[model samples]
Target: MERFYARERMGVQGSWSRHSAARVASAQALRGRDRLRAALSAMGFRLQ
Candidate 1:
């Protein structure tokens, strides 16, 4: 029981959790770019 609490307090967040955060952030950035491209195309403007 004490060991569990010690690990938690040590900030051992694990690679899986860290990877999840990075994946979510990247996904959000990709979504934002796609939205921008769609909006620009809707206005008859070329995104490239």
Candidate 2:
């Protein structure tokens, strides 16, 4: 039973790490998009 619990904890930790990584990636993508938009605006390009 203790081993089972340990395995479960490990699985939970793995999922948490994955979630954190995904969040960071999403944030970086959003920042990149914002930067692109700003650049386009500065160039006076309209998105239509």
Candidate-wise lDDT, in order: 0.62, 0.63
Question: Which candidate tops lDDT?
Answer: 2
Residue 29 accuracy (lDDT) in model 2: 50
Per-candidate TM-scores read 0.31, 0.31
Predicted candidate 1 versus true structure: per-residue lDDT over 24-46, tens digit per residue: 57656565764777788899997
lDDT of 2 by residue, 1-48 (tens): 445547777443445556556655865656576477779988999876
Q: For residue 19, what is the lDDT in candidate 2? A: 51
Candidate 2 minimal-lDDT segment of 10 residues: 10-19
* Model 1 misplacement above 4 A: 1-33
